[model samples]
Structure formats: structure tokens, C-alpha cells
Target: MDRRFANGTVNAAQTGSGPPLVLMHSLLSDRASFDRIVPTLSESFRVVVPELPGFGQSEAVSGGLAAVADRMAGAVDDLADGEDVIVLGNGYGGFVALQMAIRHPNIATRLVLADCGAAFSEPGREAFRAMAAASAAKGLAAITDVAMRRLFAPEFQQAHPDLMRDRREAFLKTDPGVFRAACEALAGLDLRPQLGQVKVPVLVVVGEYDEATPPPMSHELAAGLPQARLKIIAGCAHVPQLQAPQAFLSAVGDFLGRR
Candidate 1:
């Protein structure tokens, strides 16, 4: 069931019992990004998946990466009862996860970051600007293909037509203004310098063919952190939990085992 916490700043889906595990979603996606894997995760944890600010039922908050991290910390504080929890974030969620570790050091004891980078390359920044402008000008319907290209490998896109359609439908459902705002938020983000501040164990996973955050970015992120490792999921793209759940789960299982 969904629970309101942090004075309604977060609308979270909670299940199971054990050490808390918080899940955060990517841009253009909501809490449902983790839907397929939440049940499995919940078996071993108290899973708390929150709809990020400006997405799903969560209200949008002002400011950039640091501010968003603060809001996420609030959710963690309420859900974990001040106990540090494992935080798993994908894409945009990964950025927030890193920020939480940096800005709110006590919030997460371990972090699993999938398909996200510490910061965008110059070209990447331009791409985000272009995407935001496109969304602003023509709405999400006009950028479905653009989003699909970033979210999946070329082969996956060709083979999973039905899933691609569903993703497109989900994207269309999101408010364009929120999407644009998120893009802008990413455009101004650069967290590389502060990566060393995170004292928690971290696992950085990326799809082998992920076009958005790519493998090299994950390598850089893993190398920067004091306690981090990188895992690349073969035959997948941005959303490995959907495209290659078993591989993703195995990697996560191994990481959690060490912790």
C-alpha cells in the first residue's frame, strides 16, 4: 500500500519487513519503474519506493540536486525511523541517491546506482538541453522515440514492440512541464568533485549498451568513490531491471551479501 510521509512530501509504496530498502525512479518514469523487481526485493527488505518529486503522486519541489536530495532524505528519515537504509536508484534516481549521500551523509548506509552518471559530459549537457527544449516546444508525444532511444538498446527496441509502446504511453502521461524541469535540473548538475564524500558502500550498475549514461561514466563514478564497485549488465540498456532482471538481481544480491 502507498503511505504518505515527510508530511506528505513523499507518497511511498511500502511492503515486507527487514532492513529498509528505498527505491527511486528515473526521469519520465514513476515509482513503477521498480514494479517488476519490488516484490523480489521486498522478500529480503522493507521496500519503500517513492514517486520522485514532479513525478507520479509526489509534489514538485524547487531547487536542484541538493534540494531534491533533502526531500528524499526526509522520506528516508520517516520510513527508516532514523536507521540508515540501503538506497537503490536508477537513472535520475541515481543522481539523487548520490546527492543524498553527499548532502545527507547519514541517510544511506549502502547505495545501488543503476544507469546514471556523476555528471553529464559536455555533449550530454547539450543533449539534455535539446530534450528539454523539445519537450517544451512539442510535449512528450513528440519525444517518445528520443526517450526510447535513451532507455533501451537498439535490439531491445526492435524486439520488444509492446513494451516500448507501454513505455511511450507512460511517458505521455507525465506532465511536460515536470519533464522539462527535470531536464533543466540535470543540466546544472556536476557531482564529480563531491563523490569522495560518500562513505557508504556503493554498487554502480549500467547496461552494456546504455546510450544515456554509458559504461565509461559508471567506471568514472565507481573509481571516484572510496567504497564502490561497478557491474555491467550484458545485452541490456538503461533499464536493466526490466531488460535483464536476473542479471541485475544477481549483481545486487552479490553486493548485498557483502553488506
Candidate 2:
């Protein structure tokens, strides 16, 4: 069911019942990105899929990723009701979850960070900067293809034309300002220094073929975290949950099922 939290500052959909498991979507995608895995996951857990701040029905926040993270922390706290919850974030959402966990140490008991990293390589940072500039100058349309490429490999995109069309539409719907702001934030972001602050166990999963964040980034993220293990979803790119939901679920099931 659709619900609002943090006094309607956050909009989310909830399903099933058990320990709360919050799912955060990537910047290029919306809450629907988690649709494939939610039903299966909700069978054993209360699946809470939230549209990140500035996306969908959620209110926007300024002050870069830290501010965004703080806003989500509030919403997650409200959802937790004093009980620690588990958070699973994909791409941009992973960064938010990581920052939220850092800023609010007790917000989550565990984390599943997918297709994200603690810091971007110089080239990666440049890519964000360029995208932000191009999108701001031209509009999201100018970067729609680029964005889709980041999310899925060309071969995969060719194989699933309808999915690509839907994904492209989703990317185009993103608020240009929000997209640019997130890009700028990510361009300068470096979370490695604060990895020590996160005390919860983390399952870092990445697509073996992910070009956006890449497997190396996940490797670095897992290595830096206090307690983290890495999983590579074979033959998938970014958004493996969408591309290969079963493989994504299998990669995380054992860890997420732990008490």
C-alpha cells in the first residue's frame, strides 16, 4: 500500500509483514525498479520501497548528498519505530543508504549496497561532472541514452527494447535540477574516510559487468567497510535486480535471511 512517512516528506509503498526491509532505488530509476524482487522478498519481510527525496511524491531537499541522506534517515527512523531495520540500496540509493547509516548510526541493523562505491575514480567523477553539465545545458533528453547505457549494457538494451524504453522514460521524468544536484554531489563524494562509522554488517553486491560503478568499486567498498562481503552477479550490469532478479536475490538471500 502507498504510505507517507516523515510527515509526508517521504512517499513509499509497503507490502507483507515482518522485519522492515527498506528498498531504495537508483537515481536513473524509480521505486518500480525494485518491483521484480519485492513480492518474493515480502513473503518473508515487510518490504518498504521508497522514492528517494526529490523523486516521485517525496519532497526535495537541498545541501547535496549529506542533506539527502539526513532526510532519508528521518524517514527510515520513522519507519523503524525504534527497531533497527535492514536497508538495501541500488546505485545512487546505495550511496544514500551508506551516508544515512554513517550519519545515523542506529538507523539500520544491516545494509545491502548494490552497484555502488565509496568513492569514484577520477574518470568516473569526470563522467558525473560532464553529465551534470550536459543535462543542465541541454536537458535530461540529451543524457537519456547515456543514462540508459550506464544502467544497462548495449547488448542487454538491444535484447530488451521495451524495458529500455520504459527505463528511458523514467530517466526523462527525473527532475533536471534533482538529477544535476545528485550528479554534482556524486562527482565530489568520497565516503571511504567515514566507512569506519558504519558498524553494521554489509552485503556489497555488484554486477560483474557493471560499468557505472563497476565491480572494482564494490570490491573497494566491501574491503573498506567494517564488516562487509562482496557478491558479483554474473553477466549483469548495473541494476541487476531489474536485469536478473533471481540472480540478485540469490546473491543476497543468505545474508538477508540471517537473524
Candidate 3:
């Protein structure tokens, strides 16, 4: 279920059979977030969701995002066979996915980005900076639902009453120092210019009403990649996999089925 590498421990769930598919969840989430989509993806391929370092039961590292991202890349490299891997990342994890692809070019094959927050116009840096400042000022323990309002629309936040609270608590549990360093990594990251170098088939997914990453960012990812496809989920906010599971599965299935 889990292993300790030179970098950090990666808690992974490996099931089904076929090509190995690596899953990276969004910020404030762990590997378990993929529980809903795993069944669908496992039908066609082996699904491996690695709980990134410093999140959940995985190892906690003091390294910034780049270091953690690098460690994540190594973890995948260790598990991957000679064949390229199909990596699926949602929201902020998309940045780590991009880092993986960029750092481990040979192992990263096809990519599936769901409500990706990176790989586009990035004000992500400033947001991360604010988070760092907030953590420094009030400590990570005090952060609340108010912290996540930036990610979801006010109406969506109201409709899904418990989601923000749960996520806020989840993030708050993280080590303040590590969380702040991660924010530093996020603040320094900007992948828009490097999108052209990603030489793999890509599927860019977005929720029409997603306030976090939005449609324009998805379009940027699709437009930049050499061989990329775009799919927009209607009437959905961020986390379409959770918001509209069946539709999310269909879109992913169609894309993977093509290859």
C-alpha cells in the first residue's frame, strides 16, 4: 500500500490491470479523493493513486513544492515500467503533474488534466504568496472556510455547505512550516511558457462553472499542447469528478478509449 523512497514515502493504491495510470489529487486532498473515479479507470487500466508527501498518511517533507514535486516524480519513476504512464491530475495537483512530465519526460506519456489550475494564465503565484503570509501571521491551525472562498463561487460554496469546511480542516491539519514552503513553491511556479514542450497526447477537462481553474485555462492547455483535446462539463463547478462523477468518467473514458 505504501513505500519509502529516497525522497519521501508514497502511499499508493494499486488495483486492476493494464497500463499503469498515475493519479494526483488537488491541493488539500489526498489519494482517497480518487475513490469515485478509480472503479471506472480501473476497468481499463491499473490505477495508482499516490498520496503525495506531506499529505494524509504519507511522509512529511520540509522541501518546498519543487522538492516535493521532484520526489513525486521519483516515486512515479520507481513504479513505472518501461512504458509511459497516463497521469491524471485535478486542480492544484495539476502543477505537480506538469512538473512530473517536465522532469521525467520519458515516464510521463499521455496526460489527463481535470479542472487544472496551472498550465495557463497564472495568478496562482500571488494567491500562494497570500497563503504563505496568512500562515505566517495566524498559523495554519486558524485557517477556515473563509480561506477557500477564492476557489469556489459563493453560490456553490453555499450549495455545498460541508465541502469547504471539510477541506479547510484538512489543510489546517498540515504542518504550518511545510504548508508555507509549499505555498512558496506554488508562488514561484508558472508553466504557461513551457506548455509547448509537453510532447504527449493530453485531455484537458473543465467544469463550465468552475471558478477555481475555469474554462479559459483549460483552453490554454489544449491550445498549447501539440495533440490535446478539450472537454467542458456543463453546469458544474470545480471538482467535476465529485460534482458530476458519471460525466467525468465518460469524458475520461472516451479520451483513453481513443488510444
Number of backbone collisions per candidate = 0, 0, 0
lDDT of 2 by residue, 37-135 (tens): 998999989899998999999999999999999999989989887776999999999999999999999899999999999999999999999999999
lDDT of 2: 0.94
Best by lDDT: 2
Estimate the TM-score for candidate 3: 0.85
Instruction: State each model's CA lDDT, in order.
Output: 0.86, 0.94, 0.73
lDDT of 1 by residue, 1-259 (tens): 9998778978889998788999898885667768778888878888999988877788888787777889988888889986669999999999999998998888888999999988888888888899999888887878888898999877787998988888888888887877887788888888899999999999999999989888989999999999998999988888899887778898899776522
Model 3 residue pairs with clashes: none
Pitting candidate 2 against candidate 3, the one with the higher TM-score is 2
Per lDDT, what order, best first? 2, 1, 3
Worst 10 residues of 2 by lDDT: 250-259
What TM-score would every model get versus the actual structure?
Answer: 0.96, 0.98, 0.85
Residues 123-183, candidate 3, lDDT per residue (tens digit)?
Answer: 6566667778977998865554434654566777778778666666666766677677767
> How well does candidate 2 match the true structure in TM-score terms?
0.98
